[model samples]
Structure formats: structure tokens, C-alpha cells
Target: MTAPRRPGPAPALDLAALVADPQTRIIVCCGSGGVGKTTTSAALALAAAEAGRQVVVLTIDPARRLAQSLGLVELDNEPRVVETPGSPGELSAMMLDMKRTFDDVVSAHSTPERAEVIFANPFYQALSSSFAGTQEYMAMEKLGQLRASERWDLIIVDTPPSRSALDFLDAPNRMSRFLDGTMIRLLTAPARAGGRAGVRIVGAGFAIFTRIISKILGGQLLNDISAFVSALDTMFGGFRERATATYELLRQPGTSFVVVAAPEPDALREASYFVDRLSTEGMPLAGLVINRTHPPATTALSATRAEAAAEAVAEAGGKGAKLAAGALRVHAERMTLATREQRLADRFTSAHPEVKVRTVPAAAGDVHDLEGLRTMGEALLAAEDDTGTGTPRSRVLPLRPQAG
Candidate 1:
């Protein structure tokens, strides 16, 4: 009988190559919330710039940490240069402003008078600011604008940290549906056909629909919605066409996706789903980054050994014995934590053996500066010898599942 093949470490993702390659014009970092997606995106852009590639990193998340890390007070729709030492190339970063981007799209596609009308509409104001899928749609629109400008050699996108990693991917389709849906067509019918004649073409159901909408939204709000839809009807086709083009852009050769996750069950599960979804949609997936991984200690002492040693020191009760016991106890706790983290990572690898992965060790504290981002970039490439002597004493180990 043939034996089952044992699971092994996944192929290492060459982060340096991914960032340094000139052909890679776009890199998207996507994952669940709190998985360090923003930091990873910044680090990659910083690394690419230092490697002599002009890079612009865009964050869809509204978090302020990205701005603070880059030593900037704030970030807006326009890119801001990050002044980091030893950066041979250039790096710029920006945060998406959904409303502003929508207005920009309107200004670009419509005549000055029409754009003014659209902008002044109350419904347009609400849709631009808080409508469902607005953020994702605006992110896509901004990306399209950046690509068309060809100002940067590479663009790194930090997708929104929503619960579903697919939110960004599904944005274009969702927006298109909302624009072309039955309700929108009905609302705009009267405006398109000129006066009440358009309402007669829409039949009896239109009357009932408008009546119900009027009851909920009042006459003024319904008129605002109708006027908004009528003015936007001409631009709807352009909106969908651009969205489709951007969706195709994501599937192009120059684009690559990096799935970021923490060394935990929930994060890894989400990463797995992202990997599968990318594959199903024929999107080019580069690999995964297991961030905040705990590296094992180099000392000969194991968790069991450290615990035993601590107990012995406590029992002996000699001078400095209490200090030694406390130190040993701390060591024991760290060792246990490192072991548990490794096991979780190991499980992820076992499930997705074909996917390449790079592990980034957990830092002592939060990354809050350009220098810290540079260090993170090095860790992502596995080229940092943080332990001194130009080499690390130990590497992060694979995590195993815990017993119930």
C-alpha cells in the first residue's frame, strides 16, 4: 500500500523579488480587520522605493496609523511624499476619500453645468458619502485614475479591513447592479421620457412604487431622488464601463495580490477563503504573509525544562533565588506562547500546501515610524538578522493544533 505524503513547509515567498520587479505595477494587500494589512502595504511600498522603484501606496482603511507611521499629520485623496532616509527612489501615500472621489468622477465625465447639478442634488450627496459599497467603488475609481496617470512605477493598495475579504473584489459588480437595477430605472423613467409621459410608459406598477417611496421619503426627498437619477442616467454607462475596465485591470499580468493574516485560526481561515476566491476568479495571487509570528527562543531551555527549573529555584530559596524563579517563569510563558503560535501556522500550511508563504516575526511594540516600516520590510523578506551577529539564532516554527 502507498503511504500518505507528509506535509512540509510551504515554498517561501520572495518578497524582495515581488516588490523589486519592474513588471509588477500593482500589489494589493487584503485580509480581515486588525491583521496589519495597512502596515504590510506601507512596508512593501517603502521597500520598493528603497530598491529604486517609484511607488505609491494607497490605504482604503480610514485608520490614522498609516498617516502617523509615515510622519504625516494627515493623508487625503492626493498622494503625499514620505521623506525617509536612504530611499533612493520615491514613495507617496494616500487615504481614499469616497465622497471626493465620486465628485471627481462626476467632474471628469460630465459638463461643468451638469456636474454642478449632480453635485448640488441632495440624493447625490447622500450616495457619495454613505451609500453601500461607496468606499470600495471609490477605491477602484482612484486606482483606475492612478493607473491611467502612469505617475508611479508601482501602486500598492491596502484594501478595506472589512470582515469579508471579498468586499473590495465585489465592489464593482455591486455598484453596477445598483446603477442598473429596476428601482433606479423606475425612478428615472419620468425624467428620461420628459414629464408624466415617461410615467405612462412605466405602467401602473410605477404609480404604486412612487406612491410607496413618497410615503417613506416624502415628496421633497422623492423629487430629489428622481432628479438625481435623471441627471446621473447619462453617466451610469460610463460608471459601469470604467468599473468593468478596472476589474479587468486587476486580472492583468502586472497585478499581483498578497493575502495577509495573523498566526491564528480565524485569520488563517479567512486567508484560506481569500486564496480560494482569488483562484476561482482567476486573479493573480502572489502568496501569503503570516505576520506577527512568534520566533522560538535559541536557548537550550524548553518550556517544560524552564517550568521545572523555576519550581526548583523557588523551592531552594537561596539569595537571588526569587529573581531567578521569576525570570524562569517569564521564559516558560514566552516559550509556551511561541509553541502555540507555531502550531497554528503549521495547520495553515498543511491545509494550503501549494501556496507560498513568508512569515514576519512579532515586533516588541507597534510600528510607528518610517524606520520601523523599513525593519518590517526586511522581516517580510526574511533578510533581517534581528538577533545580532548578522544572523538570527532561531527562526519561527510551525504551530500545531491544541488539544481540547
Candidate 2:
């Protein structure tokens, strides 16, 4: 019988080597919410730029903390230059605008008149702005646009958080299905047909479909949808073609996918899902980044030992007894947190031993400027060697526990 494989420590990811490669054109940072994906993306871009490669980091709904850290005062669809002191390479950053990107696609694919017609349609506006999958689809569109521009050597994409991180992979097919669905084809049948005979042939089916949809969506909404679909029918081929091209680009050799997460149970679980999903889809996996990990305050004292010391100090009841007791309690707390984080990380490493992981120790404060990000980039490499052989560094990491 085959032996059950035992888990081992994952190989360390070398961030410097990843960005130094000339052929590495795209790096995608993706994970569940609040795991520092945006900050990681910015830090990676800045580090790469500082190392002398022109880079652009595209973020989707970045948190204010992350935006401020990257010096993004007013984020929009357009990329704005970020001043990198002492760096020969340039760095630019932008946040995705789903509606504008959709409009741009429409304007590009169709004639001016047709584009206006499609844009004016209420259904088109609604879909572009608030549809469930529109943001992911537009992200793919924007990525394609950025690549086509050839303005930068490296493109770092910070994917939307939560399950939507996977949506980009499925968005093209979802869009294709929507366009080729029964309702859309039924609505566009007359448009596809030529002259009066074609209209007569399609009129009955179109009327039935419209009536059925009109009951669920109001009459005006159904009419708006039918009109929009008809107007967009000619451009559907182009949308699908571009989406497919973007999907292929993601799977290309020069592209790499980094799964970011904290050393917590739920976040690590999400990371595992990302790893499996990327592998199943045959995407190029560039290893994992375990951010804001905690190492014990002092290796000389264990959590139990700290607790015992605290108890002894409290019982002794001297002038400084309370202060000493409080300090011991704090040390115990730090040891407990570190042990919890280590166990969680080990669980993940055990499950996916082949996947490389780079751990960054928790920072003392929130990263809010260029210097902070540079420090963080350095931490990605430095923390690996600081295994607490001597003095302790920080108490606990600032990472929030992600919900599964």
C-alpha cells in the first residue's frame, strides 16, 4: 500500500528573483479580503521599480490605508506616477473603474452612433455599473488594454477581494454565456435577420420572450434590455474575442500568480482554495506570501513559563510587583499569539508542501508611506532569517482574522 505523505516546510519564495527576471511581465496578487493584498501589490511594484524595472500597479477598490501608503491621494481609472526616490525605474498606480472601462470597450468596438445608442440604454448603464460580474470582466478588459499599450515592463494587478478574486477567471465564460443565452439571442434575432421577411420569422418568438421577461422586469426595463441587446449584438464577437485573449494572456509563460494571506485558519483556507483553483486552471503559480506573521517576543520564555512568572510576581506583592506581573502577562499573550499563528501556518504548509511561501514578520505600525513600503519589501526577505535566535522583535502582527 502507498504511504500517507507527511507534510514539510514549503520552500521560501525569492521576491528579488521574481522581479529581476526581464521576462516576468505580469504579477497578480489575489486573496480574500483584509489580508494586505493591495499593500503587497504596491510594495512589490515599488520594489521592482526601485530595482530598475518600469512597473504599474492596478488596484481594485483599495482600502484608504493601502492607498495612502502608496501616495495615492486621488485614485481613478487613469494611472498616476508615484515618486520613487533613488529608483531609476518608474512606478505608476491606478484603481479600476468598472463603468468607465465598459464604456471604453463599447466606444472602441462600435461606431460612434452605435456606441452612443448602447451607452444611453438604461440596461447597458445598469449592467456596466452594478452587475455582479461586471467588475471582474472590466478588470480583464483593463488588463488587456494595459498590456496592449506596452507602456510598462511589469504590471502588478491587485485583484478584488473575497470569492470575486476567482471571478476574473470565470468572467469571460460568464459573459459569453450571457451573450449567447436564449433571451439575448431571442432579443437580437430580428437584428441578425435582414429586412421584412427576417422580422416576420423572428417576431413571434421575440414577442413571447419579451412578454415573459417583462413580467419579471417591468415593461420598460424589458424593452430597454431588448433594444440594448439588439444594438450590442454586432459587438458581442469582439467582446468575447478580447476576453478570450486576456484569459490566454493570464495563462502565458511571462505571467505569474501570487496568493497572499495571513497566518490564520480562515485566510490559509482561502489560500489553499486559490492554490487548488490556480493549479486546476493551469495558471503559473509564483508561490505564496504569508504577510504580517508573528514570532514570539522571547524564545527564552514560553507561554507557560511567562504565566508562571506572572503568578509568582503577583503573589510576592512588592512595590514593583504589579508592574512586573503586567509585563509577564503581556509576554504570555504574545507567546500565545505567536504559537497560534505558527500552528495555522504549519497547517497550510503541510497541506501544500510543494508551494513556496515567504513569511513577513508583523510591522510595528501601519505602513503609510513610501519608506514604510520599502521597509515592508525588505521585511519579505529579512524576516526569513530572523527566526528569533537572539532578541525578540515585535509583539504581535496587525493582521485581522479573515472570515471563511
Candidate 3:
């Protein structure tokens, strides 16, 4: 057996090269909620499009930020071409509408008569709209559809803001289990078997089981579920197959997973979980993005020295003393924050030393337009410093001018 690979310092993630490559077809941005996955996805798409690659970004996030940034009044289930002036290539975007996508799948796969029946079923309505895991499953379905269209050179996916970042990856298996499960088989048995054989197949135990479930779910609801199961029976295998295909698409060579996180402990912990899960699932992890870092504008002054200087200036009580002291104190606080962020980052790197990382400094305000997204994209692809300073370009600051 081969020896285990040893961990080493993480190489800088060259996002520019990754997006520029024609072979890189799909990039999935995933992390815990509120880590800027949507922005990151949009920025990556913008970068690739400006680089002359046709791109479409699918956002599972419900927020209107992506649409706003792209200059669209709104986004829906269908892809809308974005007007990117001066860009050689094209860009399009869409938000996932789980219910509509589910309807499309049913309508596409079933006869009109059957489709209407399934659409009318109460169980189908509930499952398609608010069912657990439905969003994730629909995301997979939409992604598969986009890939089959062959309409774009690159696809960027911003995964849903779910409780767990791995929900997107688990969607296929969850769908498969639900479709082929014993519970579903039992639910549809009466419709499939019919008449006396159906009753015989169900027997006394099943009859009692159904009665208990009926009491809990109400007879009408139980009947609706049984009807829904029977109507969807023919399409069950199709759902499982499609989900499997999409899952495989994610693991393909052309696909890449980018874990987005903040410098905070909780966010980094979630990133670590995502990284570990991606490794376990054999997914191709491109790298990790530490977003919205508070890097100090200058590293020449240490926090201790800044605090000492502030105290000395306050004691001197000379001209501009209060203002100078306040400025130094502010710098001291900033330095302290930067130190904490770097310490947290180092902790993460020490654990997963082989994972590449790219840090994006926090913007002064929210990015709400194409130009802002372009700026964010440039920061993502900034060159890394190699002078043993352990500082990313986004985190580096010019030295302060010396006194005359």
C-alpha cells in the first residue's frame, strides 16, 4: 500500500488560470450561509466572461443581490442574458425556482393527462413547493438541464444557503432513497396491485399500519399521498437516474468545487467540514476562498507599538496630540483585528495544509453592480506574494512614509 500523503503549506489558488482554462467547465461555490458564495459565483462568472468565455451562473440563493449586481430587474427560472458592455464573451444568470422546475420535470416526462393529475395532487403540490431537500434536488435537476443544453462555455453554481454546505452533494442520494424507499413502495402498492391482490399484499400488518398513519395524517391526506405516489410511480426511476447523472457530473474532471468562507472561527470551521466532505466524496476541490478579511492597511507597526505610541502621544499633550493619539489607537485596534484573523487563518492552514487558499479583502460597501463585481473579480485573481511574508496580495499594504 502507498504511504499517506503528508500535509504541506497550501499553494496560492490561481483563480485567473482556473477561470481562463477552457477545460474548466463548471465551478460550484458552496459554504455555510452568509459567506458571500453568491457574490463569489457572480465575480467568477464575470471574470470568465470578460476573459472571452461564454458563461452562465445559476444561483440557488433566494436573495435578489445577484440580479441587482447583473443590472437585471429580476431573475427567474429561465436564464436571462446579461448585457456586459465591452466584454468579448456572453453572460447569463438565473435563480432556481424549485416548484417550477419540479413541474417542468413532471411535464417533460409524463403524458399530459398524467401530468395534470400529478400537478393537481395535494401531495405533489406540497412536495414540489416546501418539501425537505426539494431545493437541493431541484438545483441538481436544473444544473443537469443547463449542462445538457451545451449553450455556455462555463457554468457557475451558487449553492443554496442551507444549514449544511454538503446538502447539495447529498441531494441525489436523498432523492434516490425517497424514490426507491420501502415507504414509497408500500404507499403505491394498492394502486399498482389493484383489487383483491392489493389487499392480500398489504395484509393485516399493513392495514393496521395504514390506519395508524391515516389517523396521524388524516384520511384525505393519506389518500392524496397514495394517489400522488401512484401517479409518480412511472417517473420515480427517471428521477433517480437523473439525480445520479447530475451527481456524477459534479465529480467529473471539468467540474470544480470552491469552498467560500470568512476569517471567523465559525465560518472557517464550516469550510473545514466542506473540505473534508469534498475529499471524502472524491469531488474535485479547486480551493478555499477566505472572503471579507479585515487586513490592516499597513503591517509596519505592531499592535503593541501602536498602543505604546498612542499612550506616549496622549501623555505629551502637544499640538494635534489628541487627534494623533486617536489615529494611533485606531490603528492599534485594526492591527489587533488583523492579528486575530491571521491567527485563525493559520490555524485552518495548519490543519489542512495542502488545500490552496485565496483571500479577498472586505469591500467598503456591498457590491451592487457590474463594476463592483469586476473589482471583486480582480481581487480574487490577485497575484500572491512569494517573499516569505505569508501575506496574500489582497492582504498586503504599502509601507508608511518615514518622517522628514
Candidate 4:
């Protein structure tokens, strides 16, 4: 029988290598909820600092618990400094506030009078504050700001836990539904176009729909929507331009997107879909970071023997022995899963030889501070040195010019 072998601890990571790579400018961390993506972003920044690069880490909708980890009280657009130990590198972080970003954009684009009118309009207000794609747009906006900054050398972004990771990937176009679409005019038929067949039909439909809506929220609501749309009539093209620019920025040679996922089947599947989606859009596919990998207890035959002995003890009714064996079994199972992870990773490695691969083991506690970030950086950087002795590393990264 093949003896179970313990997997060695991953070697120290070389964060400096990733950031310093000529083609890499951005590192985006994405995964399902509760997968430690937020922590990963911070850790990369800390690691990058050790490598001697100035890093700015950004997060959208970070949990309160993790906000504590990143040394932030709450979400804000402004960046805060993060302390990195045993390194002279600089790091910063921010939690995105989508509503704030919208308000800022509106304030920038319109007169105070027009801004208030739009802000007070329920429909316009809802679109800005409660809309689905607001987070994505705001994230893009934040990236734009970071890219323009002279303070940092790198930007690490963590996306919200979304049903479709592509949501952020496609957000700019989706949010401006009214701009490119003629459906709204069709839906809100006016009495002016009476002679045309299509106008007449639309008017009749509008009459019935208006009456129903009038009874529910009153006609005032529709008036507000119309007014808001009119005031913001010129904003659509600009919004599209901004979104396109951000999308192009992602594809630049300097921006490197790190697709984050776990070893679990669903997360792995999501990672694959994201890869396919980015590839289809011609986005830069920098590399992949697999988190929460299980550590193996032994190597080769020793691991197999431990598993067998553990199973034998359980079969022999040695409850105490079984418990001891269970730990080894868990480790064995993780390594088994790790092998599967390796296979999937290998698939990518073989196909995209230029893309770098980084793996981080599951940490004991959730990361919440600069110190915790340093620990994560250490874990992420572990595989570079099997002997558990390596210096922290950071790399100076640049923003790929916004895509034209």
C-alpha cells in the first residue's frame, strides 16, 4: 500500500518579483464570500512593501470584522497608511463607499442647483445609492483615482462578493441603461407623437401604465424620474467614456489581474469562469492566487503509512487512537485535495506559461491589522523558501495607462 506522505510547508513568497515584473501594474483579488480575499489584498500590499515597493490596497464592501483587520474604522474613499514590519516599504488601504463616489461624481459634473435636484429626485437618487452596479462603477472610479496618484507604486483591489464576477467586469455599460437604450422613451410615451402608428400604440400603453403607476406612487414619482433623466441627459456618454477607459486600463500591459479562488469545487469553478470571461474581453490575465490551501503533514510513504495506521486504529475501537489518527486523516485529505488543485493549476500553467501562480495556506486566525497583513504576506511568500527562512519582499509596480 502507498504510505501517506506529508506535504511540506509552502516556500516563502517573492512578492517583489510579482510587482516588479515589467508587465504587471494591477493586482485584483476576487473570490466568493468568506474566502479571505480582503485579507489577501492587504497581505499583498504588506508583502510588496517588504519588496521595497509603495503599495495601495483597495477593497469594496469589506466586512466590519476585516475592517478591523486592515486597521480601518469604516469604509471611506481616502487612503490610510498600513504599517509593515521589518521592511521599509510603504502600504496604504481604502474601503470603497459607492454612494460617496456617486455623490462626488455628481458634484463634479453639475452645478450645485442641478446636483441637489438630481440628488433629491427619488429615481435618480435610487439609481445612485441603491442601484446594483453602483459598487462596480465606484470601484472603477476609485481605481482611476489611485492610478492618478503620485503616492503609490502599486494598486491591489478586492472586489465585492458578487454572483457574477463579471458584474464588475461589465459594470460601466450596465449602469448607464438609460443612455444607450431607446426603451425608456418607448416606455414613457408622450402625447406629442400622436400621428405615427408606433407613437399612437405607445401612447395608449403609456396611458394605462401611467394610470396604474399614478395610483400606486402618484404621478409625481414619474415626473421626478423624467426630470432627473432630463437633467442627467448629457451624463450617459461621459459615463460610458469613463467606464470604457477603466476597462481599457485593466487591459494595459502594466496591470496584472490576480484571479483569487479556493481549492473547493465551486470557487475553483468560479475562477475558471472568470478566466474565460476576461479572456473573451481581451483583458490582461496576469495570474492566479489559490487561497486556503491545506497543508500536508508528511511526504510520500510516511503520509500513506500514517493514514493506514490511523484507519486501523479506528477499526480496532481505539477511540483515543482514532482521534489522533483523525488529525492525520484530515491532513491527508487536504493534500489529496491539494493534488487536485495542483492539477487545475497545472492546466493553467501549461496553457498560460507567462502567468505566475501563487499559493497561500489557510491561516489560523482571520487577518485584521498591519501585523496580520504581514503574517499573510509571510504565508503567501512562504513557498519560495522551503527552509522557512526568507526576507520579506516588495516591488515597485506601475499603473498601465488607462485603456483608450
Candidate 5:
């Protein structure tokens, strides 16, 4: 049998070329929460800009870090330029506002009077602003709009950190669920030519609930719902088609997904789940970024010292010494555990040898601006010295931007 191939040895990634590639229009940065997915998205955009490519980064990370990463106080639907020193490419960023995107869709498709009617509708408002899939669907809508605008050469997206990052992928189906569900038919029951009297009676009963909610919320809920349904009756097909197109766009080759994971087991498992789902949906899983990984050290000296400290504490036979030794032991164990996790990651890389594996060492500080992103890119594609030597040094691995 052919010797099993090793995980395509982590290759040096050319992020600029990836952004400049005529084929790649979208880059999705996804992972579980708190793994620096937002930072990675910004850094990728900044790196592309450094390489002289026009890029835009969009995110729904409500943590406000997206604003700070671009060194802005706030964000809205509009993209803002991020100027970094010594960077030749242009970069723009925006934090997605779900409500704004939703409103835009209505305004785009309907006249002001119709939009007012739709916006005032109780069910329409709830479905637009407060529903589970509304935000995700709006995000895709934003992506589609940006793609059509051709304002930026590259659109890098950071999805909401979700228990299932694939929530984004399911958004279209979820939106359709609202219209395709029994509730719509129940409301639209009057629009159908069933027994008119019974339909009116049932509709009147629904109106009672609508009026009560309107009174409680201080909005004309019934009128809004009626108007919204009336307008939506004319626009449902448009909404359905837009959502469908967005879903298709996500799965296309022009879009590439970067799955992010920290060294922790839970994060790795989440990444693995996301990878599997992306594969199932036929979305391109461009590569993986194993972040905050502990690099190996050259000093066999420190490891030896840690061992001696434990031995001395045992010999000393005192509480204070034991406590200090315990701390040392904790540090050593942490490093040992990190090494084991890195090995586990390597196994995954080996198994998916075709997938590029980039390791990003835990950076020293929080990323809050254009400069921070530049610093991040350094570690991402930093070169290694002739390490054919004996000492095992820590290496920084970044997620590959494009696999070639």
C-alpha cells in the first residue's frame, strides 16, 4: 500500500495572493466564541490591505471588539476606512446591524407607504427584529448586497460565535419556515376563499390578540400585521428568492471558510463539528487556524529546573516549599498538556492532509487597531529559521488564507 500521506506539511500561506485571486470573493472566519474569530477576521483584512488589495471586513460580533479592532467608537451598516501605516491596500469595516439590513430589504422592495405598513405590522416586526433566524438571515442579505456593490475586492465576514456556527448556513431555511409554517396560512386564511364567515370569525379572534398586544406595546399591532401581510403578500417571492440566492452564494467556490480553534478540547471539537458540516453542505473549508497554541521551548533547562524544584520541595518537607513547588508543578503540567494538545492537532492536520494547517501562537496582547492586525499577520506568516538544529523551538502557525 502507498505510505499514508502526512498532513500536507503546514505550508507558508500567501494571504495577499488569496485575496487577489479572481476566484475568491468571500472569506468567512468562523469558530466558537472567545477564540479570537473577530481578531482573525480583521487581521486577515489588514493583511490583504498590506498586500495592496482592497478589502472589507464585516462582522456581527456584538462584543464591540469589532469597533475597537478598527479603532472606531461604533459601527453601523456603512463601511468605514481603516488606515494603517506602511500598508498599501485599502481596508474598510462594518459591524452589521440586523434591523437596518431588514429595513433596507423592505425599503428596497416596497414603496414608503407599503414599507410603513409592513414595518408597523406586529408579526412582521417580531419576525424581523426578534426572531432567532432573523439576524442570521439579515447578515446574509448584507453579504449579498456588499457582493453586488463591487465596492471592495475582498469581503471578509466574521459570523456570530454560535453554539452551532452553522446557524448562519441554516438562516435561509429558517426564514422560509416563517412563511411556510402554519402561522402564515392561519393569518392568510382570510386571503384564501374558504368559508368567508368562518374565516372572518377566526380572523377577528386573531385581531383581538393583535389589539391586546398593540395596547400593551403602545403600537398598532393589528394594523401593522394586516398592512405587513398585505405588503408581504406582494413581496414574499422576492424575500424567498433572495434568501435562497444567499445560501447558494455561501456554498459556492468563490466563498472560502476558515475554521478557527484554540488548543482546548472543547474548541477543537467545535471546529471539527463545523468542518464536518461545511463538508456536508459542500462549502469550501479552506483551512484551520489553531490559535493560542503553546510553542515548545529550547531550554531543557527550565523543565529540569521544574523537576528539581518538585524534588527539593519533597525533601524540604515544609508547607511553604510544597506550595511553591505546587505552583511550579502546575506550570509544568500546563505546558505538558499544551504539548499534548498540539500533538492532537497535528494528528488532525495529518488526517486531513489536503487541508492547510496554520498555527497562530498565542499573541501577547489584545488586538485593538490596524497596528495590532499588522503584528498578528507577522506571526501568521512569519518564516522559520534553519531549524534542522537539535533544539525544538516554539513555532507560530497561522491558518492558511488559500490552499494551493
Candidate 6:
């Protein structure tokens, strides 16, 4: 009987090449919370800048990790240039201020008087700041604005840390639907009719309906919403149009989505969802990045053998033997952890064999500066074998002990 062939490692995701390509205008890093999406986006942007591409990274994460990593005091709605000494290209970074972005959209599309009316509305104030999906929608709006400017060769997007990774992809459509939905059209019908006709449009039946809605929503709140809708009546079509355009932009050839996840079951499952969604939406997917993986320093010694050696050394009971045994125990523990991580990664690979993947070993400390980011960037771009054994350069065995 013929033996079953063992599956080879997943195809390597050449992130370096992906960023270096002039045609790659946008790279969006998205995944579940605490998966290093912010760090990955910053590192890739720094790497691309050093490689001579004019790069801008926009982070929607509220944690401000990206600012710290980029060595910036603070980041706001506007793009701020990051000083990269001895680099061939320039880099800029920004954090999405959703409220400001929403205001900008209104001001840009509306007459000054009308914009003032919309901005001063209580409902608009609430909507711009804390409405459901506003942050995600504005992130898309900011991305669309950045792309339309044609100022940078590459735009790296760090998606928001939402409950669901799909929120980012769903934002534009959600916003478009909100603007064009039946209820919104009904609310603004009076405003569209104008003056006396506006009053006539809200006749006995409509007045009764409004009264019922007022009882449910509170009369003041409903009035505020009607006023807000009235002020925004002319700009609704513009909102829907821009949202549709941005959604289409995500599906274009120049854009690529990199799903980032840690080497754990839940994170990898989220990555799988994102990968499948990207395929369904026809978005260009660059690959998967498995971050903070615990690959063993040396795979030559199996965990079982390491444990046995440690036990034997401890039983011998020499002066330095205790220390040596401790070291061996530590190595054994590391090997065990690495094995678990690898198994989890393998399960993901088995499910998604065609997706290219790159694994980054866990850093000894958090990356909080440009130098640390560069180190992470190096690790991200490091080549790995077909067996996914991690970076070959760092996989050396321990040196032999000297005999006294």
C-alpha cells in the first residue's frame, strides 16, 4: 500500500515584496482585538518607507500603541510626518478622529450655513461622536480621502479593534444603508417638501404616526432627529455615493488585506473568518500573518528528551548540575509551548492550505519605539523554510558546556 504524503508548509507571504510593489496602493491590517494589528501596520509602513516608498499609516485603534511605536507625541486626524533618519523615503502617520472626519465630510459637501446647522444639531453631535459603527464608517471615509488625494505611494491601514473583525468591511455598506433606508427617507420627507408643503405632507395620519413614535422615542429626541435629518437632507445622496465608492475601492486590484492573528485557536479562527469574508467579497488578500509565535530556539532536541536529560542531571546532584538542570527544564518548557503553538498553526493551515502565511516569533519585550519596530519589521520579512520552522538564522543549538 502507498503511504499518504505529508502536507508541506503553507506558501510564504512575501510581505516585503508586497509593500515594495508600486502598484500596491493600500495595505489594510485587520483582525480581532489584541492581535498586534497596530504594530504590524506601523512596522510594514516603516519598512516600506525605508525601501523608498512614500508611506502613510492610519491607525483606528484607540489604545495609541501606534503613536508610541512611531515615537510620536500624539496623532490626530491630520497626517503628521515621522522623521526617519537615513531612510530613502518619507513616512507619515495618523490616528482616525471619527468625529472630526464626520465633520469634515459635512463641511466639504455642504454650504457653510447648512454645515453649521448640521454641526449644531444635537442628534448630529451624538451621531458623530458615539453612534454605532461611526468609527468604522469614518475610518473608511478617511481612507477614501487619503486615496483620493494621491499624496502617498502606499497607505497602511490599522483597522479598529472591534468585537468582530468583519466590522471594518461592513462599515461602508452600513453607513450607505442608514442614509438610504426607508425610515430615514420617511423622517426627511417633510424637509424635502419645504415650508407650507412640508406641513401639509405631515397630515393627520403622518401626524398620528409621529405622535406614536414620539411616545416611544420621546418627543424632544424625535424632534432633534427630524431637525438633524432636515439639515442633512441634501447631503444624504453624497454620503451614500461616497460610501459605495469607498467599498468598491477596497475590492480593487491596488488594495490588499493582510489578516493578522496570534498563534492561538480563537485568533486563528477569527483570521479564518476574515480570510473567507475577503474571498467572498472579492477583495484582494495579501496573506495571513501569525504574530507572537513561540517557535523553539532549536528543534533538534525533542521536549521528551529534554525533560529526561533535565531529570537525570537533577538526580546526579552536582554543584553546577542544578543550574544546568534548571536550564534544561526551561528549554523543555519552551519546547512544549512551541509545540502547542505549532499544532494550533498547523490546524489553521490544514483548513486554509492555499493562504500564504508568515510567522513572527514573539519579541522579548513590547515594541514601543522606532528601533523596536524596525526589529519587528526584520522578523516579519525573515525567510522561513517550507516546514514553517521559523527564521533559520536564529535556530541554533546551545553551545556545549566546558569541562573544568
- Name the better of 2 and 3 by TM-score: 3
Clashes of 4: 35
Q: Candidates' lDDT values, in order?
A: 0.84, 0.83, 0.86, 0.67, 0.74, 0.84
lDDT of 3 by residue, 27-55 (tens): 99998888888999999999999999999
For candidate 2, lDDT tens digit of each residue in 259-354?
A: 999888888899999999999989999998888876665567888999999999999998999999999999888878887876677678788878
Model 6, 38-126: lDDT tens digits are 99999999999999999999988888899899999999999999999999999999999999999999999989999999998999999
After superposition, the stretches of candidate 5 with alpha carbons farther than 4 Å from their true spots are 1-17, 192-226, 299-338, 350-354, 383-404
In model 2, which range of ten residues has the least summed lDDT? Answer: 391-400
TM-score of 5: 0.79
Better-scoring candidate (lDDT), 3 or 5 = 3
Q: Scored by Cα lDDT, where does model 5 land?
A: 0.74
Model 5, 1-404: lDDT tens per residue? 56544343554344445666868889999999988889988888888887777899999777788889788888788999876777788889998888888989999988898898778777776877787777888888898999989888889999889755567787777768877876465556677636978777878876775667667755555555655676787677787788789889888878889888887778877887887788888898777877777654432435457767888887888768878888767666655755566566766655555666566767778888777877877656544432332222222322223433
The count of residue-pair clashes in candidate 5 stands at: 7
- Angstrom error at residue 210, model 3: 3.6
Candidate 3: 10-residue stretch with minimal lDDT: 394-403
Could you tell me the C-alpha RMSD of candidate 5 in Å?
6.8
> TM-score of every model?
0.89, 0.89, 0.90, 0.76, 0.79, 0.91
By summed lDDT, the worst window of 10 consecutive residues in model 5 runs over 391-400
Counting clashing residue pairs in each candidate, in order, gives 5, 0, 0, 35, 7, 0
lDDT of 4 by residue, 1-404 (tens): 66543222223235556766534568877767666777777777777777777878788754655457767676467888765557777777777888788888888878899899888888877877777777787788778878876578788887776545457767676756655566456444453356689776877787777787678877887777667777776565777778778888888878766677776667766776777777888887656677876545433434467678778778887548768778768766765665666556545444455545566777777666777777777767654434231211110011113433
